[model samples]
Target chain A: MKCGYSYDELTAYFDGELPREEQSKLRQHLGCCGECASALEELRFVRSAVLSAWQAEIQAPEDLRSNVLGRLREEGAFRESLPVKTPVATGKGWKGFKGWGAAAAASALLVAGASWAWLAGNVDNAPLNTALIENKPAITEHIPPDKEVKEVTEKEPDGTAGGSATDNQPGDKPGIKNQGTAVTSPEKPGTPRQTDNAPQQTATGAIALKDYTGKAFLSVDKKSYSGYFQLTDNWRNYDSLDQKIKLTAAGYNAALAGSFKDSGGVVTINVPTASYNALYEDLKGLLSAGGIVKGSDTTVESIESQYKVVQTELEKVREEYEASAGDMEKQNQLANRQNSLIDQMEDLEQRARISTIAIKL
Target chain B: MGDLKTDVLIERCRQGSEAAFSELIQIYQNRVYTICFQLTGNSEDAKDLAQETFIRLYGALPGFRGQSAFTTWLYRIIHNLWANELRKRKNKQTISLNAPIHTEEGEIDRTPADEKSNPEQLIEAGEERKLIWTAIDTLNQEQRTVLVLRELHGYSYEEIARGLGWSPGTVKSRLNRARLHLKEQLLKLGVKPDKESQKDADIRKKVKQL
Candidate 1:
């Protein structure tokens, strides 16, 4: 067996899904190999950090059980009767069940109506930060006032009832505590607090954050900087744009990293993650100056799993050698397997850290 | 149910016992709500989803042949519902991370109101925690779902695969993507944690301070 294993096996090993023999060998390789060890460490850290972050836990509303039970009662989804046959209510949060429910619903609808009126031009400027249930503090990035949302909001008819992007009540900036001249308020009223808050330390021992983007994306897939992007832009001003990006990088303390140019107006460069945003904008402006921009995507998961496969294969070889301790051929086979898998893992790890960009003229 | 009682409750629920069903809800409410809220990111929708999950479980309980653990089955239902709702909301373009999670204390911001109690170190920790969550919530649904199931719910790879109706390989890959995405978000947050392991409480306390 080759020392290399498939990425799936390595992932499974991390999840404790591998058989004992396979696990033992992978452990052996992991102990000997820095790349695999690092991969494992990263895997664990991401998982732990993410899950711990998930600790911004929220409990279901106290009335949830009743609401569901009432709905079931109304719909007759269950035949079993409850021990306590509490009165059923149709309104949300029991507020609606009372006669006041109508008034509350009307008020809510009114607010929704007014919000749509205000939201057309505003509602996402303050970086909406809502406290979660059970004291879990969660801050949502302000959704930038991009065209898609603006267009969508514009196309919708008036008094369309739904929650606005800024779910907080108007003028209630619940999360932000100003220590300086922070940009918390919208340029005008009725904007949702959805700006990306970047905090800076002030000279007066206070922390202030500025809201940058009008709104941020809701998912990683939609996020501007989330993927390994293959960006393509019309190189109409390829020369000047290239120079502009260099300047932009310098301005942002970002590196252009590396670039390859050809006569066909094709240029490829490694943009440091920090400076990629600025360069990307510059690319967009050049394209707008009369060109097109396109990008392809690659996921890091693919590379990590591939490394795991190599790690797993290597482990199998070590197991084979361990089972046949004194066999010279087997000992030699184990050594060969270890060498092969170690190299494979390092390659995958390197690929995981680097993002590739290919630009054409 | 603590241990053996869980099995008994399952039996009762399977037999159409409302008491047992209510018991199940009481016991697992936190777990169920946690998953639901994490997926939906809205307290209102989460409540509705949680109720719907239990109601569905009530109907599906009789078919529960004990092939898998009850929690797994319940979570499967939750995952299916949450995913479907996400797709529907996405299709309608109505989904927004903008919705504030409602709590008993009215709508509170994800950022704590007062961090004056927290010292500087604690504040840094809180900021890191917040950064992590913001990243996690921003994760694409597929990857986010796999991550919540594995990392937070402690589901085995095979179990998650079975629950999601995907191959175990798919589960691992999604988790990888989710983790890397998380790492990137954290990197952007300027939180370069030393390669040492930190306890969840420390993270939580720090976050609370924020």
Candidate 2:
């Protein structure tokens, strides 16, 4: 009776979903109401348009058929290579049997061998109990050099090593007494001297460094300390140290490895010892200013500085060594841990460097 | 099995006969390509989709049970592949709205030689066709597929339902809705409806209702 019909009824009218009685009623309504009539007309036009559009001419490219055939051939070849069920005729009837038993056996053997090797490798790398026992003393003695320095510098005159006021002590000038105590008292003269000559431990503990500075694979350039600080600061503010170190090591090795020729002659080498020290001083300044109060902040700055120095020196050695080493020998030594570390550092530095964007005024 | 020629070709193709496969492709290529083009609204996408359809069909041929017509099965495969491709490209932010006018060698010749048939009228009709196609592209994939199969390919409702794995009622309803949507679009394009068109529409509505 109403002009506006339910969607279901409209759909039925459109789709012939109505019964004969309803269809006649709908038609009677369409014949009378201009709006419903117009709606039905519009619906017809839309349907015809869709139908014509659906019938529009189309053709595949000339090469498409050939390409499809070629792909099919490739798939066929691959299928042929796989073990296939073949029909074999016997006195009874045709029976289906799979062939390539030998090939399957060979494949299984190879998989088994690879799995065994992987398991053996994992077992060999299992943390050695002996090494852990051996490392106990060294680990205890290895007071994180930074923490030791901080503990010594922050000590109070009462011999307590935490937060305490020097103003409480009679006859003590705040700045002078604090500085004197920080620089001299806690470290006995002999203790400082002994620490300076403490044996340089090799990274793997099997080798010893007669001269830690000289034997160091990585050394930051002291002269470039200011530049290194700026670079690292730029890196920290805009980029990540891990990413920079990774990228730098990657670029360095890629250049040194001759896989990439440096057009700008900027190999993006790591921060040298001097630069690292400068960064260290910057960190210390930050610490002194209370900017490095957070544990993460202090640890990140110190580690970043140390890693920069080590990475720079290592790259230099690698570049020099690469020049003298035979190509085959270098290839063979590609899996060496030392080389891997150098590569990792270069990669980090490269990533860090790229992340630094300059804004032009 | 009664159609020996087709049966032999199918058997040969199943047995890895390249020539047989090529022959089959040639025979069915246009229909399949047209179906793909209608579904995808682009020639390049249609070609790739058609090729993939054939590849899948060929791979699955060995397992095809003769429960349905071979062409029916092929249509089902093409439809499924096109559906997947549509889903894949759904996330792409950019889409060209203009329907491609066939300019290549085998384009449908719209030129009417009879002078009485006005060239202006033919041109108007062509433009109308283009608008209609553009509107068709707006339909959802299933609605579009059902409409195309019914109108362009002239597949029976049962065949379409079987191919698309929808109930007969679903096919009928979807086709009706799709047509109605298209009709509304055509009215927007300023096509005037007449009594004759209304009567034809009435008959179609009646057929669907049955």
Candidate 3:
């Protein structure tokens, strides 16, 4: 069938902007119409060429941040504005879920710097930084499984713990949750803490490959969420890395299990530790520089020992919580610690069973 | 930045927090610079435009009523600033798209290039990239702005219209013309999608479907 669709429609369709009914009709037409398909293919060539030319991960000059901030400082612009009570302060379900919120905030802050490094092409020991931050592989859109986690937090009578109340800043959506396990209180205005996620030392050699294993936490229904390594290599980006991971996983006779719920670019696959190195080497070729650090070196014995340490911490927090009289603040802090410890144990237990490599392209 | 986090930063900025403002700059500096660079096609101009955009953003924060996505608002500021710069240079050339070419069947907005005109030589991926940038360099201000907003930033037609303060029809037609013109220019430069890119495109399409 010959399609008479105009070039405008074709461009819109190629960009995935066509409306649903028109999109479906166009899709059917392209399936049967060689002329339209070839036209669409040509458009892809143009996009690819343009992207290749202009999209090679250009970083703002190192001093741009300092320069912008310096300019603002000179004008006293930052000093003139004050925090206003915004209408979007809808964090009811998130008030007491300090563990997830803090971890997410911490990881977000950490990844903000790490991704700048990734684009700047100067990530020194990126894998070690990744391990420390627990930043997911997908630099953008790495929100953890929130529906189940939020439900857990909602059951508690005291969900509004920590400094969230004092923070008083609005604009928190209850629905979207940030993913990561690191913790930090949300920074207040005027505080010098967490001012800059300074770019790491420049990467001079190939990216060291590390085991991109993630910490899995199964909810009450057996669904698991983990922190995946974000694929930030600008040239290959997400699509190329995704394809590479799939091919490597198949070659290793592994199950490309599934991705985390609600997160795009995160893929969870279970490759045997024996065949992991071959798979790792295959994937390493995809990286431009900065090798992945071997993050998942936890043995059965090491996990066992770590599990014991977390258990002891949990016990200590539990004792403190029980011993506390009527101080809500102290009790709240203890409760948060207890919850964090329990989550750690669950993470350890899951790691003991099988290693899950989540590639967030 | 996550929407919530960005909101927090905006709030802090309003609260006269220099640290919060600095963090905001850190998060968005690269992106803002990329937009500026794409429009100006040079690092120096891009740096100046980006710095100017933030300075304007800081001044305009009290008026940002959260009516639009922060990015949408920010990009709108960029477009306005760039348009103003082009006016100052007095070189803002709007491609004359009003003329239609008469074909045997009917009038078309643009003539389809003869497929046989494309060079058959297989371009190395690196070489292809250099040629692509050269082709991009040939685009005028309007075409380059539309292409950058659509392809690099992935803004939709409606969003582009709203950001650029044009009607949806204008954005759609301009973006389409920009794409076709870029393709035509690429072929003119003897650049075609090499085998590697073709394979990657196929793989990307399948992944998108999955």
Candidate 4:
């Protein structure tokens, strides 16, 4: 304290922060009092001296930048997804239900809607359809190869021949009730056999004839797409939803590509890129409004092309490494370039095969 | 640094664009490092704090809704992290002095370099400037923080209060106390202002001429 004023008052005066009247009084006191005057000057000198040394910019270490970027890249796929809360148009109906309950309800609706659509179709009597469903590539042992499809079709009226014969075959899984198999039946005019490999107009139109794990596809058979879908289902439904997702993927022959890692909400599955649009349409029917946080699509070709570009660069670097064998530094740089390219290629390869549909149930 | 560019970069970062985030680091790294250095008074810890700041920014990009300026949000992270570090240091202070310092590289010896005791480093700067830095280094965390923000960064009392989550009255008092503490430290360091204060030198010259 000085001149009957607290240090706060003097500091405020030094900063021009004292009220106009009090500032004038302090200024008057300072003229007669050397102590108050020097205190104010000392404040000014301290500020100037600190500013002089530190005003120059200080560069952060270069490795700090790399370490941050490297850590982010390392966490690339497993990073927590952004909380995207965009309302989905279809999810609006289940607005009352929360979390997994909403998802189960929506999926239940999908099962019923699919069953109704199948029962309404006249293709029920088609023998070739029976071959695709009852005698799936896995269950070929049950169907007699000599029986003509037309003859099998004609026996549908009797109900005794085809139904009774297949009933005793262990191939008839309990859920394979005609409704489950027929729900995924092709809706287009194409013959049922053609639905096995070709992309169809509807998500339910193409059915997986071969078990998902049976054959290694030689070509890029899937596109890459991701979605943030919310199901107002709660934690209690996690097990049931987990089982249903597996069954649903099996029903459609889509591979359950993702794990139930995060609170049982995120379910990732791989459908043939040909069936990508169809599966996307199928999910839109299951989620509620505000359920779809985001959806994005990218082509398998694009991912492959990116992989190819990285491969080409890797090859170029390899050639450089081979040519500069005597130079250790250049070789070290080439090795690092190769390692990063390999990492990128591996990531793209996995992405090309999996069309990630992140159903946040 | 323009609002439009920052917004674009922020949006890209939210969308998981590493390139844009790297660019943001480039733009603010120096400023962030400077603040960290000023607070910690050591290059190694400053680097660690700056790296931690960017990594936290990356994780938190999704939550940033542009409610405040990017720098303001960035400073808040630094402030919070520093507070945590201070708490951790306070806990460690209870340990024996001979306990090894656990750093990222490994455990280092506890024999910290005495910056003031070295005459060669002190002589590298003008005496007043050196004294100011030494005084700042000796001040408590709150005083140093308030002094650096209010004086060096030109932040208003209200801005400091809002950023630090203190009341305006608290900011006023803290800044006042910080200045006086700093003044006392400078005087203790034997900082004579005749050479430092241009006004005092000018007055002395006129008095001599008269």
How far is each candidate from the true structure, as Cα RMSD in Å? 26.5, 28.6, 23.7, 22.5
Question: Which candidate leads the pack in DockQ?
Answer: 3
What does candidate 1's lDDT look like per residue over B4-50, in tens digits?
A: 78889877664334567677878777678777876665566677678
TM-score per candidate, chains pooled: 0.43, 0.41, 0.42, 0.45
lDDT of 1 by residue, A70-125 (tens): 54433222223353334456425321122223432333211100000111223342
Q: Give the per-residue lDDT of model 4 (tens digit) for A1-361.
A: 4467766677788767778999999999888987778777877766655555464556677666666654343323111112223311221111111222243233221210011111111233222343333321111111111234435434432111112211121112111122112322211222122111112223232223211222322111122222221121121221121122322321322433322322243343333222333343344333332133112221111233345577789899899999998999989888877876765564444334332333333
Candidate 3 local Cα displacement, residue A55, angstroms: 3.7
For all predictions in the order shown, the interface RMSD in Å is 15.8, 18.0, 15.6, 15.7
Cα lDDT for residue A16, model 2? 60
Question: Model 4, which residues run further than 4 Å from truth?
Answer: A77-361, B1-4, B63-68, B87-128, B167-177, B194-210
Q: CAPRI band of model 2?
A: incorrect
Cα distance off (Å), candidate 4, residue B172: 4.6
Please give me the total number of clashing residue pairs in predicted model 2: 43
Model 1 TM-score is 0.43
Best to worst by lDDT, what's the order?
3, 4, 1, 2
For each model, chain A TM-score? 0.23, 0.21, 0.23, 0.24
